[model samples]
Target: MERLQKVIAQAGIASRRKAEELIQQGSVKVNGKVVKELGTKVTRNDRIEVDGIQIEKEEPVYFMLYKPTGVISSVKDEKGRKAVTDFFPMVKERIFPIGRLDYDTSGLLLLTNDGEFANLLMHPRNEIEKVYIAKVKGIIDNEKVRKLQRGVILEDGKTAPAKVKVLGSDRKKETALVEITIHEGRNRQVRRMFEAVGCKVTKLKRERYAFLGLGALRPGDGRALTPHEVKQLRAFASATK
Candidate 1:
C-alpha cells in the first residue's frame, strides 16, 4: 500500500505536501470518506477525490530517446530550429519532454503523453536524481569536489547538494571530466554549477535520469519504454512521499 497523499499527488491533484494539507483539511475523500490522517494507506484501485471531484485516468505512454545536440526539446520552435519531433514522425500522438536538455547538451530524455507521470518525475520537490558527465576547464581538486558536494553558492541561490566525482583529467588540454548527480532541474544547472566554481563547461551530457539510462541508443533514436521500467518509475515516484 502507498500513502494516501502520494496516490492523490500521483493522480495529478496536487503536490505530495499540498495533498497532505488537503487531506488534513477534509478536502480529500477516499472511497467517499474524508480522511484526515496523514498515515492513511491506499491501493491503486481505490477511488480518490479532491474537492468532491474525481480524477480521470489517462493512458500512460512513455518513450526514451537519446537526444543529440542542436535539437530543441519542444514539438516546434518559433525560431525554425529543429526539434525532437522531427525524429519521430511516425508516432502520431502528442508527447512532451519530462524535463529538458539544453540545445548543446546530449543524452537520455524521457517523453510521455501522461501528465501525471511527467509531473511525478519532473517536479523539483520530488528530488529525483539526474546524472550527467561534464567536460570543464582545469583539473578537479579536492576543494572543488567538496564545494559541489556541500552545495555551491550560485547567483540564483545555493545549489542543492550534488554528488561529484572526478573521473579523469587531461593534462595536455588542461581539462577535467567529472560526473555529477543532482536532483534539481534548474535551467543549465549542471553547467552553471561548474561556472560557480570557476570552471567553464565545454561539453555536458546527461547519462541517467532516475533509473533510466541512455543505453546503446544513438543520437536521434528512441524506443518505447518497457513495462518493467514503467513500473519501476512509478515505484520511484511513490517512494518520494
Candidate 2:
C-alpha cells in the first residue's frame, strides 16, 4: 500500500500535488467511497475513481517537448496566459514538467507523471547537465568566456562554473553564438551569466539535458519518450547521485 497521491501519480492520474488538490476537493474515491483526506492510503486491490470515472493503474508516461517561446512552464497560468499544458490537450493522463523553462526562453522540457522520477531529475544532488545555445549581442572575448567557465557572481550570489565555448560568430551582425553547459538550474542563470559579462542575450534555447537531446524536434512539437530513454534518464540520475 502507498499514499493515495503516489498511487494517483504513478497511475498518471495527475502530479502528486494536483492529485492532492483533487483529494482535497472531494474528487477522488477509494474502494467506492469518497476520500478527502490527504494522507489516505490505498492498495492495488482498492478501487479508485475520480469524478465518478474509474481510475486504472497505468505505466508512467514521459514526454519531451520542444517548447516555444512565450509559453509558461506551468500546468496552468493564473493570468490566462498560454501554458505548456495547452499543447497536450489530448493527454488523458495528468503530468507536470520535471523542472522548468522560463518564458521567452525555449527548448527541451521533460514532462512526466512519475513523481519519483521527477524528484530524481530535479534534485540538485543529481547534477544533470543541461546544454544551451545562446545568441548574445556583440562578440564575447575568450577572457570573458573563461570567466563563465570559472564562475561569476550574480545578484543573488556566485554561480557554479559552467562549460562555455564560442560556437561561432556572425561578424557582419556583431552577434555571437555560444554554447553553455551547466549542471545547476538557477533561475535564468544562463541569461544572467551572459549579462554579468556585459553581454545582452537575444535568444536562448536549451539543446540537451542529461542524456536527452532536442534533436530535430521543431518548436511546439512533442513526443512521448521511449522506455529506453526513460531508463537512461533514471540511470543517469542514479549515477550522478
Candidate 3:
C-alpha cells in the first residue's frame, strides 16, 4: 500500500503536494469511493479517480527539454500565458519540472513523472553542478571575474563560490560572454551575481546540469533520456548525498 498522494503523483495526476490539495478538495476517489483523507493508503488494484475521471497507472516517462525564452516552466498557469507543457500536447502522463528557469531565462530543463528523482535533483544536499553561459551588459574585468570565482556576498549573505571565466570579448559592442558553473540552485543566481558585480545580465542560458548537457538540441526541442543517462544521474545523486 502507498500513501494516496504518492499514488496520485505516481499515476501522473500532479506533484505530491498538489495531490494532497486535490484530496482535500474532495476531487479524489479510490475504488469508486470518495476519499478525502490525505494519508489514505491505496494499492495498484484499486481504481483512482480525479474530478470523476478514472485514472490508470502509466509507464514512467522522462524528457529533457531545451526550454526557450518566454515560456513558463510550470504545468499550468492562471494568467493564460504559454507554458512548457503546451509543447508536449500528446503527453498523457502528468509530469512536473525538475527545477526551474525564470520565464525569460532559457536553457536545459528536465520533465518527468519520477517524483523521487525530481526531489533528488532539487534537494540542496545533492550539490549537483549546473553550468551557464551568460552575456552581461558591460565589459567585465579580470578582477571582477576573480571576485566572482572566489564568491561574493549578496543581500542574502555570502554566495557559494562559482567557477567563472570570460569566454571572449566584443570590445566595440561593450558586451562579453562568460561561462559560469555553480552548484547551488538559488533563484536567478547567475543574474544576481552579475548584478552584485555592477554588471547587468543580458542573456543567460544553462549549458549543463549534473551529467546532462544541452548538446546540439535546439531550443524548444525535447527527447527522452537514455537509460544509461538516467542511471548515471541516479548514481551522481547518491554519490553527492
> Residue by residue across 80-173, what tens digits does model 1's lDDT show?
9988777778876666788889999999999876656778788776788999999999767899899999998877899999999999998788
lDDT of 2: 0.89
Candidate 2: stretches off by over 4 Å = 1-42, 47-58
lDDT of 3 by residue, 213-233 (tens): 988899999888998898899
In order of appearance, the predictions have TM-scores of 0.77, 0.80, 0.80
Residue pairs whose backbone atoms clash in candidate 1 = none
Each prediction's number of clashing residue pairs: 0, 0, 0
Better of 1 and 3 by TM-score: 3
lDDT per model vs. reference:
0.86, 0.89, 0.86
- Ten residues in sequence with the least summed lDDT for candidate 1: 54-63
Number of the predicted model whose lDDT against the real structure is largest: 2
lDDT of 2 at 167: 91
